[model samples]
Structure formats: structure tokens, C-alpha cells
Target: MINLKMILRIMGILSLIEAVLLLLCAGVSLIYGESIINDFLMVAAGSVIFGGLLLLMGKGASKQLNRRNGYLIVTLSWLLFSAIGMFPFLISGYVPRVVDAFFETMSGFTTTGATVIDNIESLPHGLLFWRSLTQWAGGLGIIFFTIAMLPLFGMGSMHLFSAEATGTSHERLHPRISITAKWIWYVYFGLTLALTLFLLLGGMNLFDSICHSFSTISTGGFSTKKASIAYYSSPYIEYVISIFMILSGINFTLFFYLAKGKPQKALLNEELKWFLKSIIVFTAIFTVTLTYTSPYGVGESFRKALFQVASLHTTTGLVSADYMVWTPFLWALLGVIMFLGASSGCTSGAIKSIRLLILGKMTKNEFKRMVHPNAVLPVKINKIAISPSTQSSVLLFILLYMIIFVASWLAMMAMGVGNVEAFGTVVSSMGSVGPGLGLCGPVHSWNCLPDGGKWLLSFLMLIGRLELFTVLLLFTPQFWKKR
Candidate 1:
């Protein structure tokens, strides 16, 4: 049976943590001398009260959690965080509609980076900071963030980690899961700080540097300016963000190994090797295309190609130039990149590189088996044979991912969205990548979409951010049956 009381208690703790984050934004408001401080404070107060009530109701609950409780808790927690996270926007009249507020908040927490706001710079510094914070906090994951603290509260994090952690295999840098989380956070924080310093040196102000650093390290594309990185028009800024976006797309566990003086182990990762190779290949293709077709010279084309390829490949969604106006072939290539996504266990979303790596191996093995009916050919990754179950799981995941994409694409078209826009939006939403083709392109906000479309995309973002099965499994009838 599900551990209902324990789930409530844990959610209460999460709400309190969220309240603290809100207060930090309020502090930012104070620093900026913005009157929106009251809006943040009011929401923070509400979070505290709501959290307190949950704690009271969950008093004396058993601490034990099963797989069922873990999945349910993770899904509900995301919804709960989004529900509470929307209030500051609502109270401040920034995102006036309930659907708009929820969609924006969900996008922030999921690091999807889609926005409805036309004038991003007009928002107060505090709200912008909060918006970036949501992405940064969610970069690794919500449950993963509290793993270190979960043990302090007399709870084990194994089930939670199993349910919510990304990638096909969980890497353990340390024997203790909490220690592993801390080590990963150390890498995450260090990268964010390094990127911030680079942006500052590139002539960006401290606030913009910090905010963009948050978005970049999280592979989130929220910008403090209206025109995104294009507003700066600095080649140096573009290159720096491009490099950092690629770095952030790497699996955090690999960074841990490098940090621990095991450079060979990290360097030998097959997925990392393939991911880098893919970037170089895509960048080269883009550079050649833009160099010949556009007014940009080879150097400028290379710069733009590197930035755009790295951005979308990592699902960062920070646009240097609008890709929609590019050759149809180029934007189509970017759509494929968005679908492929970055390395697993990092900030970005979509079908991760590790899975793709496995899928490629599986396809190869199938062909080999066809050649020799009696011979056994096992799929391998990084020189280790992949289990049959894992191979099947990867295949099933890709199938379901495509199935949902088709279904959602049709649904969007039925909702009065144009064919091109509908296709782009569904792919973008399902992959948790910001910007779409046509009307919802990088230059435009998603405000043109109907309320129903926004809500549908919001659901897509949640499921995508949770890696498909975690959220989808909750809807299955068998998932609710007592074991």
C-alpha cells in the first residue's frame, strides 16, 4: 500500500524548502528596491502555512516508503511545487491568468524555458531571479536536491532516487547516495560559478551574469533581456555560453570521476565521446550551410553554428540567432538535435545520449543476429554487455516517446494550431526544449497559443522533465493495485 502520511510529511518539508527559496527572491526584490517584495512575501507566507498544516496532519506517520509511494510522491511534489510556485506571478499581476501563471511556473521548474511574456526585461529583478532559481534548483532534480537532507529526516533516498534520477544506470561516486548527491552538487555549483565569472568578464553586469549562469548551468534558456543573448551582440559572450552549455550537458557523475583524479574513467565514457562527436559534426554542417547561404563569413558562421548547435543539442534553448529563418534543412536538423537531447543525468531533457548510444548498439546487434541465427550477439556499451531488460526498456521508451509525440501533434492541430506550429510545439514541449517553428519560434512567446494548448504543453513538460515513466506510470491501473 502507498505511504500516504509519509508522502504528505515529505511534501511538507519540500514546501518549507520552497518557502525559503521564495524568501531569497524577496531579498533580491529588497536589494533591487522593487515593490514586488510584498508579493513574494505573501506567497512565502502561504507556503509556510500550507507546509505547517501538512506537517501537522502527517504527524506520527510511518517513515517507510515503497516504489508506489516514491512515484506518487515525486509526481505530486512537482505539481504541488508548480501550484505554489505560480502564486507570486499571480499576486504580482505579472502573469495575470491562472493558466498562463501555471504554464510559466511549470516551464521554469521543468527547465523547459518556454515563455509567454513578450517583454522579459520589464519584469522586476526579484521575479526574474526567482524564475532562474526554479531552473537551477530543478536542474539536477527536486527529489535529488533533498536526498542529502532526506537521511537527516530519518528517510532513505534510494527509492526516490530510483524513481526520479535520470539515465539508464545510476552512477555512484560514493557508496552513500547522499554523498554522491553532494559531490554532484559541488560540480554543478562550481560550473555555475565559473560560467558566472566568465559572463561577468565578458562585460555582462553581475545580475545578468548570475541569472544567465543559472539558466545555462541548468540548461534552461530564460533570459533577463527581451532579445536573449542577441541583445548583447557580443561574439565573446556567445562563445562562452556555447562552451559552457556543452560542459553543462555532460553527465555530472563523469565530472565527479574527473574531480576524484580518475580522468581515464571519465574520458573513456562512450556516451560522452559520442555526444562530443555529434556536436562537432552538427556544428560543422551548420557552419558550412550558413557560410555559403548567409552573409556571415566563415568565422562568424562558425561562431553562430557552434552556439546554436550546442544550445539546442543540450536543450538549453538560448538562441543566438533565430533558426526559423535559416534554411529549412538547418532548422530541421535542430529539431532532430532537440529530440536526441544531451547526456543523461545532467540538466537537459529528451531522449538522452546514453539511451541513444544503447539504442544504436541494440540495432547493430539485431542486424548481426540476423546474419547468424544460432549466434548470440549482446548489445554492449562502454565494453560492458547490456542486459536484455535494459535493451528492451530503451526500445520501449523510444517507441512510447514517438507515440506521444504523434498523439500530441495531432491534438495541437485539432486545437486550431497550424500544422507547422503544432508539430514544432509538440516536439518542443515533449523534449522540454524551448522555442518552436513558425509562430512559437524563438523570436516569439507562446502567448499566441490557446489556453488549452498551453495547458497541454504544461502536462507535456512535466512528463518530459520526469523522464516519461515516472509520471505516466501513475495513470496506469496496475500501478494503483496493492502488492
Candidate 2:
């Protein structure tokens, strides 16, 4: 019932591609003369051998995959990807521990930007490139990238696409899902390229520009320097990255609309409207808070607030300053934005804004329904009526997200972590918004977290990246029942 052969075959392909990406990183290491080249090659070789074996064993599985298979494969590939990707850190003795390496790689692939390494600058060029590369691959999603580029995966492409993509906000922009995938990728890569050029123009070096652009456009927060965006201390660079972070958080389809000269349609998108408004609202509030307390001038405070707010709003972990240094209230406010991540169809993680919009509408509709029992009232997003079933799913997702958040918080607290760290870590990790308050706040690495906390947060990153259902559904008895 599970399509084990098909799963293995597809996983093989995923691994092969992963190996190829690693080899590219190895090339960077070779050029930079980093000693980590051997670690990268060893893992790539292992990936190749294992992938070839899986392909050979599952030759019969080269068929169209069912919806169920898509879900399983997507979930399995993420797990396997993280599991294999950790080796460079482990084998190189950079991370030393399997759990630490796994946590780092998982955070990267999930684009969560949480790091266990205490000193990122000391890492060699190759390892740094690999670090940035993970987020780049993860930004749009590794499987999503595979489906778009590899024609062999055309069967069930939509199933894989839907299973892996975020939100129900937008459907295929193109009639053919593969075409839609390519178009989506064009926008993704185009944005990355444009952002790289912008950063280069802002005086960033080529390497930092490309690396930061990869993270920025993907909304993955991995930064090349220890101080993140703060390392540059250039207002121009900060503003450029801030703008792109906001742009990246937008649904990619909206870009497709703009490119197709449907700017009016894209501008009319309800989620886009809400997203822009939310950014403005958050930026204003955060700026006001900083202005009231921070020693910096009003303009500087607003700039800092805008950059940090955009970073957190998009779930990009790049920080312009140490947020923990801010007032506790402001720090808590950042946590709130972390919970309500960017637009649904983008890379940033969390409950997503579309659901928040839906929740707001649902709450208003409930009050209206209460006032007039017999009157017909419908909830609509972008003028399209939302069905009762869709509302139920959204409601359930929020409820489940909260439950898991609380459970993770409790679990971390139980592990002897402080309240602030536990709360911030759980919410940030569960939301896939790296950086939290107190000990785990901006400017803090996860090196201090206990082993259990690392593993727990790693799983949280995976589930958060998958948007919960794909991973959570595996535990349901119904998921295993054969039709």
C-alpha cells in the first residue's frame, strides 16, 4: 500500500541530485583549498553508491506515483536529505557529534537558519559555501527543484508539487504543473540573481553577495558573517536585503502575474494586500518601540526596526542587531511576528498570513452568524467564497500548531532550559524563524542547547518546513489503512 519500491526509486534520484550539489560545493572547496574537501567527497561517493543501488532495486517503480506516494516520498526525502547532508559537518570534525551535524543541516535545509556552530567565520570557504548552498536548495525546496528540472518526475508532478508547496492560497499559474514549476523557478532564480547584483552594487563582495542573495531570496536566514547583516553595518545593504526579504516572502505566483503584465491582478491578491499591510504595521510598531527606548536616533531606530522586522516577518534569521538587547516587550513582539510568518506560498515558515486572514474572517463571520441564525453568510478571500471544509482545515491547522508549540515549550523547559529560552526557542523553532529571546536570541548560537533540545528542535524544523500535515499525518492510523 505504501509503494515502497517507488519511494526508494524516487529517493535515489533525490540523493543523486543531492550528491551532485555536494560535488559542486566540493568544487568550491577545491578552489578555496579548504581541508573539508575530503569530507564532502566521501559523502558524495556514499550518496552515489546508495542511490545507484536503490535505483537498481526499484527499477520496476518507474511509474506515475499516486497522491499517497507523493506525500510519503516528500516526507521521506526531507528526512533522508537532512540525514545525509549532515555528514560534511560530522566527517570533517566541524560539528563532531552526529546530533549537532544533523541539527545544523536540518536547520539549513529547512531554511530555519538556526546554527550550533559558535564561530561561523572560522569555517573554510568550501564549508561556508555548502552552508549557504543548503539554504539555497532548501529555499524553494529540494523536491520542488527536482520536479521542476527533471522531466523524469513529470508523473505525479502536481501531487509532489502540492504536497511540498506551502498554503492553498494559489494554484498552478500554468495549466501544466511542470510548466508551472518551471515558471515558479524562473521567478525564484531571477529574484536570487537580481538580489545578488543589488547586493554587489551595495559594496558587498561577490561571495557574500551571492551567499546572502541565496538566503535572502529564499528567505533562508543563513549569513556569511558572524554578525549577520550587522557585520556590514551598511545601511544601503541592509535596506536592499530588507526589500528583497519582503519580496521573497511574497507568493511566487504574484511575481508570475507581474511578469505576465497582470500587475493589476497581482496587486489585487488579498494575501499580497494583507502581507504588505502587515509588514507596514509590524515595522511601525517595532520602530516606535525602538525609538522610545533605544539610544539611537529616530531614523536609525526606524531603519533598524524595519530591517529586523522584515527579517523576522519573512522568517529570515538575519539580524541587524542583537534583539535581546532590546526591551523585553519588543523582544516579545518579535516572537509574535515569528508566529505569524510571511505569505503562505513562500519560503518563510510559521502559521502563515493567509490563515491569519482566514481566521480573522472566520471570527467576524461567527459573530455575524450568531446575530442572525437564519441569515446566509459566507467567508470570502479575494472575493472567492471559502467552503466550510477549507475553514475547518485552517482552524485545525492553527489549533494543532498551538498545541505542538506549547508541547515543545514544555518539553524544552523540562530539559532544564530557562523559560525565556524555552518559549523563544520553541516558538521560533516551531515557526522555523531562527533566533529567539534570552539565551537563544539573535547573536546567540544553539551551541548551548542540550542534546534533547537539538533533536526536538530538529524535528520541529522538519515539521515546520513541511507545514505540519505531511509529517504529522504519518502518525495517524488512517494514513496507514489500505483503501
Candidate 3:
């Protein structure tokens, strides 16, 4: 059964945190000139009032929520958070249209980095801060953040955590979900602080450094400048972001192991090895291509190739240069890399590299089984046997992900968008990768997209952010009916 009261209570808590975040953004506005202070404050107050009322009504709600209720709450909370989060954009009149506002907010919160706002640099300081804050909170996840930080959620959080976390495994670094969340956040925070300091040394202003770190560590690509990382024109800054983006793409759990003084755990980790090797292999291919095909010097070509490969591999959509003008083959190569994102349990979206590795192993296992029937062959990762159910679920997820991507791509193309742009947008939004190619390229924005296309891609962003099953299950007949 769906625990409506529990859902409300949790949603209330989430909304209050969101309200507090908005207020923080409002404070940033106040620190600057006072132009958009009212806009942020009014929305923040609304969030507080709405959240407060929910809290009052939800007093005495049962805390024993089941898995089904958790899924429902997780999906609804993401929708509600995005809905409420978009208000600053709407109230401030910066994003006047509802569809546009929702898309921008959804992208930010999903860490999708797909933006409809073209004049990003012209936005007020408060709104820009709000934009980055959404990504920061979303980096680890909003519900995970609330459950881990706020003691209010308590032990009932596991269901919600399972519903939101990537992959099938719920392996815990600590016995309690809250403690696990704390350690995860500690790693996330440390990385952010370190990245910000490095960016400062790389010559970014305090504000830009902070905001870019938020987006970068989250694998989110929202930039204050229109040209993204190219605005500073600093190779130092580009390389720094590249390094952090790769780090952010690794499983946060690995960081926890390292902190706990378990070096071998990270070293022997299958996912980390795959992620690292793919980065090196992809970057090498790209470097060779750029070196031979592009007019840049050998060193410049290698630098560009390495940075872009890191960006694409991690699904961090920041652009140092316009790669769309690169050889068509390399353009296609990057698009394919977009499909295989970095490690699971990180902020990156798309079919994660871990899943890709699982898929490959499963395929090999199948071929091996063809040679010997009734053999007890199990897929193993790091010497641990993977459950059959996990392998099956991973396969199904990839299938469903492709299906949705294709359907959305068809819809966008039907709306008269260019074929390449439509395909890129579908993959980009579905994977939460920021910039698409051709029309929606890094140099361009999604402002020119038709309203219908915006709505479709926004739904894609939500589904992708929830890891597909959580959102898709809501549409199933079994989910809505009582057992």
C-alpha cells in the first residue's frame, strides 16, 4: 500500500530544505544588489509555507513505509522538487514560460545540465546561485541528502535510498543509511572544496569558482559564461575540471573505502578499473584523431582531446572548445561515449559504465553457456558472483533506456527538429548529459526547441534521473493496485 502520510511527511521535510536553499540563494542576492531579492524570497516563503502545512498535517504519520511507497514517494518528490525549484525562474520572469522554467529546473536538479536559458551570464546573481545550488543538492541526491543530514527521516529511509540509488546492490559502508550518507557527503564535500580551491588558483573569480565546482563535481555542466570553460581560456582550469570530473564519475562508495583505510578495496574494485581504463583508452583515441585531423599543434590537439574525452566519458557536458566542428567520425564517437557514462553511485547519468561491464560479462557468459549446457556459470565482479536477478535487471534497463530514447527522438524529429539535434537531445537529456550536437551543441542552447520537444525531454530527464525503473514502475498496472 502507498503510505500517503509518510510520503507527505518526507516531502514536507524535503520542501523545507529546498526552501532553505532558496533562502540561501536569496541571501546571495542580498549580498549583491537587491534586484531579485523579492523574487527569491517570495518563492522561498511559499516553499516554507507549503512544506510547513504538509508537516502539520503529516504529524503522527506512520513511519513504516514499504518498498512500493518508497518508490512512489521518490518519484513524486523529484517531480515536486523540480516544480517548486523552478519558481525562482518563473517568479523572476527570467524564464517566463512554464515549460521552459520546468525544463531548466529539472535539468539542474537532475544534474542533466540541459539548459533552455541562453543568456545565462545575464541572469542575476541570486538566480545563478540557485541554479548551481540545485545541482549541488542533486549531486548526491535530494532525498538522500535530507535523509542523511536530517535525523528526522531516521531508519525508514532505506526504502527511499534503495529507490534512488543507482544499481541493484544496497551494499552499505555503515550499518545505518544516515551514517553512510554522511560519509558519502563528506567525500563529495571534500572534493568540491578542493576543486573550488584549485579553480581559484586557476584564475576564476570566487563566485565562478564556487559555482563551477558545484556543477563540475556533480558532473553537471551549467556554466556562468556562455562559452562554458572556454570563457576563462585557461588550460590550467580546463585540466583541473577534467581531473575532478573524472573523480566525480567514480563510485562515491570507493571514496568511503579509501577514507576507511581500505586501499585494496578501491584497487580491486571492478567498476573503478573499468572507468579508469575507458578514460585512458578513449582519450588516447581522441588524442590521436585530433592530432592527425585537426589543425591545432600536437600539444594543443592532445590537450583538447584529453579534456573532451574526460568530459564526454564522465558525461560532464562542459565544453572547452566547439567539438561539433571536429571530424564527423569523432563527433559520432563522442555521441557513442555519451551512452556509456562513468561509474554507478555517482552523480553522472546514462547507462553507467558498471552496467556496460555487466552487460558485456553477461553476453560472454551466454556465449560460454552455448558451448556447455547445464553448467553452473555465474557472472562475477571482483571475484564476487553477481546474482542472476541483477544481471537480468541490468539487461532490461539498457533495453528500456534505448526504447525511451528512440521514442523521444522520434517525437522530437516529428516536431521538425533537425535529425542530428533531435537524436542528440534525446540521448543528452535521457543520459543527463548537458549539451547535444548540431543544433543543441555546446555553442548553442535549447531555447529554439519547440515547446512540445521541451516537455518530452523534461520527462526524459526525470525518468533518467530516477534510474528509469522507479519512474517507469509508476505507469505499470501492478504498481497502482493493492496486492
Candidate that scores best on TM-score: 1
lDDT of 3 at 406: 87
True-vs-predicted CA distance for residue 262, candidate 3, Å: 1.9
What is the C-alpha lDDT profile of model 3 across 164-273, one tens digit per residue?
88575766888989888888898899999999999999889999999999999998888888899988888899889999999999998988778779999998899889
Model 3 scores a C-alpha lDDT of 0.88
Q: Please report the TM-score between candidate 2 and the true structure.
A: 0.98
- In candidate 1 the C-alpha lDDT for residue 131 amounts to 88
Q: Global lDDT of each model?
A: 0.90, 0.87, 0.88
- Residue 478 displacement in candidate 3 (angstroms): 1.0
Candidate that beats the other on lDDT, 2 or 3, i.e. the better one: 3
TM-score per candidate, chains pooled:
0.99, 0.98, 0.98
lDDT of 1 by residue, 149-268 (tens): 898888888778888884589888788988888888889999999999999999999999999999999998888986789889999999999999999999888887887799998999
Report clash pairs, candidate 2. none
**Model 1, CA-based lDDT:** 0.90
Error of 2 at 123 (Å): 0.5
lDDT for 73 (candidate 2): 85
Lowest-sum lDDT 10-residue window in model 2: 149-158
